[model samples]
Target: EPEVTQTPSHQVTQMGQEVILRCVPISNHLYFYWYRQILGQKVEFLVSFYNNEISEKSEIFDDQFSVERPDGSNFTLKIRSTKLEDSAMYFCASSRTGNSGNTIYFGEGSWLTVV
Candidate 1:
């Protein structure tokens, strides 16, 4: 089965540096999403995209964050300025259904560490 894959399995950034996490979603999937789990917290949705535009986004996806599908299979999430609080395990997910309404599969996660 095809699965989502993330690059730079781990990342360490300075408090205000920019960071971009990359993912290759399933080939046939139509919806893509970003979610974060802050250490012991529950997984939280960040944003969802489809058809080249954002379909849904959470409050956590503020001015500092953006997402793009620059290629057929590649999806990326960029944080313009990282904060210490931004340290979390960022998971990229995809599904055949639309945003916020599908049982998406997640990557192992890209761990972001900011200090």
Candidate 2:
């Protein structure tokens, strides 16, 4: 089975700094998403992209955050002016379709620590 992959498994950055997390989702998947878990908190959806546009985004996905599919296989998430509250395990996920029943494969996760 194919799996999502991420780069820089862990990172430490100071507050107000910019951070970019990279991912390569399952090649055949059509829907891509970004989710974050702040330490012990439940996983929270940030945004979803499809057909080269944003399909949906949660409140947590503010101006400070951006997503891009820079190429055929690369998906990236950039956080501008990071804050302590932004620290979390960022998961990149993808599914063949947006249907709720479809399985969404997730990357191991990129851990971000804001100082």
Best by lDDT: 2
Give lDDT for model 2: 0.96
Report the C-alpha lDDT of model 1 over 1-115, residue by residue, as the tens digit.
Answer: 7899998899999999999999999999999999999999999999999999999999999989999999898999999879999999999999988736667999989999999
lDDT of 1 at 86: 97
Tell me, what's the RMSD of every candidate?
Answer: 1.4, 0.7
Per-residue lDDT tens digits of candidate 2, residues 1-82? Answer: 7999998799999999999999999999999999999999999999999999999999999999999999999999999999
Give candidate 2 regions above 4 Å deviation. none
Q: Find the 10 residues in a row with the least total lDDT in model 2.
A: 1-10
- Mark the 10 consecutive residues where model 1 has the least summed lDDT: 95-104
- Residue 15, model 2: lDDT of 99
